[model samples]
Target: MRRLLLASCIALASLSGCASMGGASSSDIAAVLASPSRSADDRQRDARDKPAEVLALAKFKRGDTVADILAGGGYYSEILSGIVGPDGKVLLVNNPGYDAFGKKGYTERLANNRLPNVTHVVGPSDALGIGEGVLDGAVIVMSYHDLYWVDDKMGWPKVDAGRFLDQVVRALKPGGVLLVVDHSAKQGTGSAAAQDLHRIDEQFAIADFRRHGLQWEAAIPVLRNADDDRSKNVFDPAIRGKTDRFVHLYRKP
Candidate 1:
């Protein structure tokens, strides 16, 4: 029954002509962050994450139909639902093998209908299964490196990054935002550090997106940690949640 309920929600979101707002404002974010409904853990991360700033930079507006790609257990989904309001929708896209990382089921976030305006999309990374011209924006947060790092043994199929991003680009409305926040690797290593260190070279990523017709917009250092040496895994005890990260915001134009 839980699976059925989740499927129904995804179907509702997949339908074309869903209403989406144009641009977001500061109040939209402030209200979402300040809402008492947000979990304690969610609020605790504010000092490190600054989600309000992330949302503002991404231009996520009220009534917007956005996809929280690689959204594990709805941390961002819940916040987004509050920001977008009842009229809006947040489609949480999770590729296979996502549960192993968190030791939680794919429906953990969707269970009991905790987020009334949220939907779960389970599929291959390259084919999002979302409709064209339907998304106001899509935010891929802290997990872009997985496109190059996911191994077959992990039950996740190899992602064709070009196709995956192409699909995301197609789903957005004109001038729609596609914001990627990821751990920063060394200056010239490219994707070499993805599997081991769980990071990616910033310049290499920009070039990859440009190849897919995504226009470069802005890069913010909101999550920068100067002490991180870009050597050990992101989960290392020394830098776990404090690794230097780059917020690369782009557009489909």
Candidate 2:
């Protein structure tokens, strides 16, 4: 039965104009946001997160298989599901630590198989359980810093950043897109801020992805907040939702 459903979904997706080149239009995104199935909480967050604008930078097409890596509570997963329609698939991936942290949220979002195209996968940081060259696109939103974080008590162990990235890079097909969005740290701080401030140095992130052989495609400044001094923790009450963030897009060669 499950296989039949997926096959039907793929057939429907193949018929969509979404498979054509270029990103989703503003109208298309707005329509997704306006979905009655979407939660009121997610709609409220759209004002601050600007999800429509961020997703536009990804240039995802219909029938595209995408992964929302370390997706906390499946916020972007739900949105991606709408954008991809019935043809594409959305992988809502979460490491063990993140799964524990966001169990309630994801459980609620995925209840009753509300998102048929989304598959929830929970695995370790080093092995995300996704196959090589299978993904057409992926996104890491605000959670990439977790790669550099280590908290034994919280169940987030020290991750092998290189190996972790290897899994992600290997999962993307040639020409597949990677979109990374994270809170920015001060210049030259590198991953230093990741552990304490929950932020990363923007330049360091670009260079890190480049080292993995993904071509730097574009940097969109839709979420930049200059007033953020890149000092406080992203969870700090003073700047929780107002931190400066960097949005970078990369592609497999």
Candidate 3:
């Protein structure tokens, strides 16, 4: 199955010149959604993730240079690769703090460097070092709140949120998009929930994004779970994957 995906990608590369013309098409989403090469594990998660819809909401397109911030184990990286086709590229980035958990699996996914157009970028949270105006879009999947996460024992750095936002802004080209999805924290709660509950207030997130000059484009409520109490830690077994989440899209001017 892996070979089939690889071969398909290789074949696509040969026809890539014409693939970028229309940006991402509905067919692109359909192909990725139906690909036989996708693993059962990924397929199982699909019911909960609704990736194709998420990608579509972000208006992700062919030939885009997109980044998956704190891309843990390349789940979205792999899907974006298939969606963007051979003409596009996906940059999977991990900061030092998050790398401990993600590095090994990410390396394994890229073993033999099979996904040619996908590149792994590692750096500190404060300084991403992405080339200015190089990226067309970026996504933070349930990870935007990590800007406030700190774990000394595990070597997680105390992230400076403002500096991190500055770096993200610098990485994007004008009109580039930024998509953020995260677990919802209680209303009126600030960064406290981010550290304790592994979540954030959606409004707080929007304020931060606006502060960094990203205009809020839209919000998707597909993942909302009204029953979620939003008080417990997100890792609690019962609400782990079912935690109500917010999907927000922003754009650079």
Error of 3 at 8 (Å): 3.9
RMSD of 2: 4.2
Model 2, 46-83: lDDT tens digits are: 99888878888887777789999999899999888877
- C-alpha lDDT of all candidate models, in order: 0.76, 0.86, 0.81
RMSD to the hidden true structure, all candidates: 6.2, 4.2, 2.5
Please name the candidate that would achieve the greatest TM-score relative to the true structure: 2
From the highest TM-score down, the ranking of the candidates is: 2, 3, 1
Top candidate by lDDT? 2
Candidate 1, which segments miss by more than 4 Å at Cα?
Answer: 1-22, 25-27, 99-108
Error of 1 at 126 (Å): 2.4
> Could you tell me which residue pairs clash in candidate 2?
13-87, 18-62
RMSD of 3: 2.5
Worst lDDT window (10 residues) for model 3? 10-19
Q: Assess candidate 2 and give its lDDT.
A: 0.86
Error of 3 at 140 (Å): 0.6
